[model samples]
Target chain A: MTEIATRDAYGKKLATLGEIYPEIVVLDADLSGSTKTEFFAKKFPQRFFNMGVAEQDLMGTAAGLAACGKTVFVSTFAIFATGRAWEPFRQSIAYPHLNVKICASHAGLSVGEDGASHQTVEDIAIIRAIPFVKVLVPSDGIETEQMVEFLAKDSGPCYLRLSRAKAPLVHEASYQFQIGRGHILKEGSTVCLFTAGFITSQVLAAALELSNQGVSTTVVNMSSIKPLDSKLVVAMAEKHQYLFSIEEHSIIGGLGSAIAETLVSSYPKKLVRLGINDEFGQSGSYQAVIDHYGLSTRGILESLKKELKL
Target chain B: MKKRSVAELEDLACELRILILKMVHHAQCGHTGGPLSCIDMLTALYFYEMNHDPENPHWENRDRFVLSAGHTAPALYACLIKAGYIPKDEMWGLRKLGSKLQGHPKLNVDWGIEMSTGSLGQGMSISNGMAMAARLDGKSYRVYSLESDGGAQEGMMWEGAMSAGYRHLDNRVALLDYNGIQIDGFVKDIKDVAPLDKKFEAFNWHTLVIDGHDMSAIVAALDEARLVKGKPTAIICKTIMGKGVSIFENKPKYHGVAPTDDEFKIAMQELGDQ
Candidate 1:
């Protein structure tokens, strides 16, 4: 069954982890219910601390917990979790490479009515700049669940950017994810469609349309942007004539830019970088904003038809 | 461990000042004034109060030191070197290429440093995090942060202060170097942070106002900080900016700017003789 929501998946996963790992602690800036970290809070009251609308203190307290050899999962809105408390993560967590997971919910334009102030599009770029931080944007509910457990077990600072809206479960329950490796779910190499996060599902739909038009394509789930799957991308680019990268964030300095930088330095190809195209997203329903900004599956098909001369 | 005597701590503070000045002079640049003003407090912690070992800085039982007023790194670096935490000669390469000493105090390059702190008003939050972590672990080690009075005006500092007080973080001790001068001008003339004692007390911290220059007073307050069982302690030390240097003392501009060669010679001659 497709999961209710990525936030709901996070709730179930956090509760499961809390049961197994006694050293796991949950910290939320009063967004426990919204972010789905309330699962862990309910299961483990002593281990969970609702920091109450204080992002800076929340980040620091997470750092402190990590220093004491506990796996600390700090949950809040993406904007406040990554923006206001960036320094503490830089100074205290990433610099020290502590065992802290900065789990942020409602990433990108999916954060609906709260508008531009709360929707975090630049988070990937901002977090990717930090030397030792690992950025993870899981494609769906199942991946969010798997990645939370994966990051908790990995002994370093990691960010799990969660989506608020429900998404199609593209991967099977047994699907395992490597921390820095991208998986090529669809394989044929006339052109490579590369992407990450919930948007990868859109890329998959675009690939199906391109296939019927007799243009072969390869699709990659670029889950980890910082330690990108350069080897896989280079191989695909060498095998293909064109490269297409997409995301729910800016085309500048995000997954697309990261892949482009790798390809340009390694194996350059004809590429189209797709997303919000360096503009802030507006406040509206998820579908309205996606349609308004031309970041939908149809947008991907249109961009591909233009690139492939369909 | 035996506590340092008042006269002994006083003489130690003088030695620390002389060492700090020479360390900066070796590099020919550093924020000397603030460091000079805060050395007694730092000396009291490293030399007397805090639980740490130069041999094993990451020791689980060792007390943590977070320098929130990170620009005064020269002073901390000098004291670290003299006390044998960092190599003595590494002091010469303060901000040069590949040197552990960046403009601000960052952690892991050296043993005693717990976090990398450069931007103002940040270390308090980091220190609070570490203290809360220790509390959760049921650890006995205390976390202490040294922050400047002017830097304390950042809203984040108050946020951290509120968190510390609310959590009842008795294991944390934040020392406020109430040195009146910031880089722009006298703190009073620029952005007055006066009525500091009342301000910290209002934040739920046990406030202790004392002479930052007096070694005995600093030691006493640190002793008192240990006595406050369930609440964090904020030691507000009223200090003269550029205290030891005759020409630079009480001058706001000297907060970041170092002395010229002739001025350095005179300052050196005066400090060295004393």
Candidate 2:
């Protein structure tokens, strides 16, 4: 499987789309090189603004540009963009429903050696709480490209959560990504694996192992966390007795929490949430962190086997 | 829009002060001192300086005004009402439930509000964005932002200040309402933002200091702000916290407190119902 960082895909797609949509303006808070917004900045130097490590100003400036009829895209590390400048994001952009796309990169424990401070497991939760914001975490590079294209033509504010590590391509080139829709990777009946972002690839591998072990599992990508695929979640819940949610974020308010809310309200079921507990992440390699947290393929397979008694 | 003379502008400011007092007193919960301090500059911007149309509030080529110190929303409402952007009757609905006249300025361009701001330290960045947008689109319109002394203490204000100065946003002008009083205490006692003019100058802005209450000086400073070619201008307006009514003037207690019934009568008397 080919692997590409979602941020790289976002940068490439955004720069390409910039040629098509001249109205698209990009801003960054001095993390263009890491966030991969450097591509857009380098290509469209005149339209790009490096706000100089000022996340609050980045959000506000994006709102102002959007108010003036520019389709703006602001970028920075997830910790700074969603945590340091949360209010500006909520007040300036989301409240007014401006046409600014906040593409925050380096989300989750995938931030690796940067440790607990830089690794944000709560970006989804905090950003999702803001009204009028569309929260999207793409599963792979192709999906990231498609989302970038979709959001450029779409109106209103959106938060596109991207990761620093390269994600395994879970879909073919012909894959169609849409807002508020879940993509079913593999179908089965006994168990269901609902996952999002980079965690989907690991869940896919775990599901395949479960299939070989005679414990058939279904794989669904719940990328759009805010306007979640409730119908799909309900349908999957009805088809499978063992339902599980996986993410690289905290189990408290991320994809697991979103799915749990959907299930309890519409169709109640027992959900095994596999992700970070109420503890902070530590310094290590990307795979090391995920493996340590039981999010890797083998770790997830073991957890599933233990839960199902298989 | 016809430009008003200095005397007419001063009369308009006095009328606006009366309206502000009425709104604050009716709401019984809104900032009083800051609005009273900034009304003259707001009057000069809406009546004499800004190239905006009340009828066509969304006109693309018009100059943009962002009230950074949005706690003083009454000042904005008074100007919008006078400019005919909002109905004169809406003044009574200030801060009421379901009112467009929110405690903080909400972005309703039809009401002549360019941006939604109440949280301090945001308007400066928004103004810079607007100025950048104007430059990107090849539009020659200017962007003006109103800042209070309390708002200046925010770190994001300096972040935005640096960007505007670095970008050389010549079409941007920021007016600081240097009234010295905040909700807690005098700004100097709490966190001094003195030598503000020198600070903007250091940031590469054309800095000017003038009496905020003087209508002629307000107009002249804004006029001078427009001629500078390569840098944005910062016009620091020295003002009294509550300028119209002598009793409330410089009284920190009146910063967020509404006038009492007895105090309202005295204020109305002092502002003169001419």
Candidate 3:
């Protein structure tokens, strides 16, 4: 329990938030333990509901709770939570801006052994395109905790993207994480690496490797992908001569595209983007898939080196 | 919590219908049939039954209304404007690009619209969540949702129904516009959702069968729904498609058809001095 998966962090934050707000309700699609909402379920059984394995109904039910002024967080894996239930989330939640937080686990390559089908590389893009949804991808365990608490009282609907794998705590316990603000992890001049979710550390590792090879990189833990932390991103891009964005998503509409959009509005730099090259992944081991798809930390370093002519 | 007089409620319903027609006609698109079927129920809730504030749509204690039969958005939109939840001018912009009035009910376009409902069966489950939430919070507000009988075939609607009943959300009220016709043909032929009352009963819901277009019957059924306890209530209001308009009434072809100018004119004349 000490070094918990980010999924369990969701339950802890939700239970804490629920104690404060009577209207807070938690829903799970039979993944209460997996998504860590089981904690809330046990503590506040009346306030928690298990909508079985039906993701679509689960989403609709959360929207219903939101309709009555209850701040509801629905738990499920990222792929089924967003993909299977996208329409209800579209009409009942996002379109209406219902105050339901879709707290999903097993996001990105962190889902590991479940393979590409369960890994949600496109969850951000799918929800970000929605009209009124706020997309939050936390960098690490502490940040994930902070985000769940923040979204609890937030005015509109939000999607809390989480990781299946355990990540080292990035921010200090007292460190505050703002929903739309980007956190500056490390600062340098030659290159700026913008990334989100679990990939924050992956890109950071790549940047560090590049640093040892005589390149100074500015790494931004871009947690709020929808808002893009435009001011910091633009400023970082302006200072760095080159920009590289990486994520555990499709290169087309993921964090990289969002960074490109922000940087385009201000500073224009020679940019390199990396992720799934617009293709669905296959079933494979977690480490094997990361290695095969060239998404591991070493992969990122190698790709950046090749792109920068290292 | 006092009820409005029959005459006032009837007048509100007519006014709402006229407003919906005018907006749909001006916007050059809107679903006309289900709105006609739902006006009475919407009027009963907004003007009489539900506890709500027009000024603050998101007021926590306000009674929630979800139009599960989302194509009937014009009816809900018209009632919201007429009741002062939003400005009346907003209706004219219905279905227009950049307008708050969307082709289907959506929240991003407008504040008063509760949830975006276009796909048929999603709303009832949402209402279940709302009602269940109210119960959990020990709140006085109730949730009301109306789904089309055509929408009844969807697996999720029944899922929500069974769950709402299982949870005993007695404060939740669901109305069905049992007008029979779907897009391709009658529900009996396309997909029979008959035995709906028994289905709900088996789901542990207190059920009521009423004439959908009858003001007295609709209002009385809602009152009875309020008194029921230990289980949710669903009123199966039998109605005719395009109610009150002779030209298109009960016609399946008019399900998604935007009436032509000629059809609109005849329909307007048939509605008679609204």
Top candidate (lDDT): 2
10 residues in a row with least lDDT, candidate 1 chain B: B106-115
lDDT of 3 at A8: 72
lDDT of 1 by residue, A113-147 (tens): 77899888888989998998889888887778788
Residue B62 CA error for candidate 2 (Å)? 0.8
Q: Over the stretch B78-186, how does candidate 3's per-residue lDDT look in tens digits?
A: 8888777778778778888898778887763235677778899998898888788777777888888988888999988988888888888898999999999888889
TM-score order, best first, reads: 2, 1, 3
Worst 10 residues of 3 chain B by lDDT: B106-115
Regions of model 3 farther than 4 Å from truth = A1-4, B1-23, B46-62, B77-93, B96-102, B106-115, B258-265
Q: Compared with the true structure, what per-residue lDDT tens digits does model 2 show for residues B1-274? A: 6889999999999999999999999999898899999999999999999899998999999999999999999999999998899998898899999999999999999999888999999999999999999999999899999998999999999999999999999999999999999988899999999889989999999999999999989999988988998999999999999999999999999999999999999999999964
Local error of candidate 1 at residue A13 (angstroms) = 2.1
What lDDT score is found at residue B162 in candidate 1? Answer: 88
Candidate 2 — which pairs collide? none
TM-score to true structure, per model:
0.95, 0.99, 0.89
lDDT of 3 by residue, A66-96 (tens): 7666788888999998899998888778767
Residue A134 displacement in candidate 2 (angstroms): 0.5
> Candidate 1 vs. truth: CA RMSD?
1.9
Q: Share of real contacts kept by model 2?
A: 0.85
Docking class of 3: medium
Please write out the lDDT profile of model 2 over residues A1-310, one tens digit for every residue.
8999999999999999999999999999988999888998889999999998789999999999999999999999999999999999899999888999999999998899999999999888898989878999999999999999999999999999999999899998999998999999999999999998987899999999999989888999989887899999999999999999989999889999999999999999999998899889999999999899999998999999999998
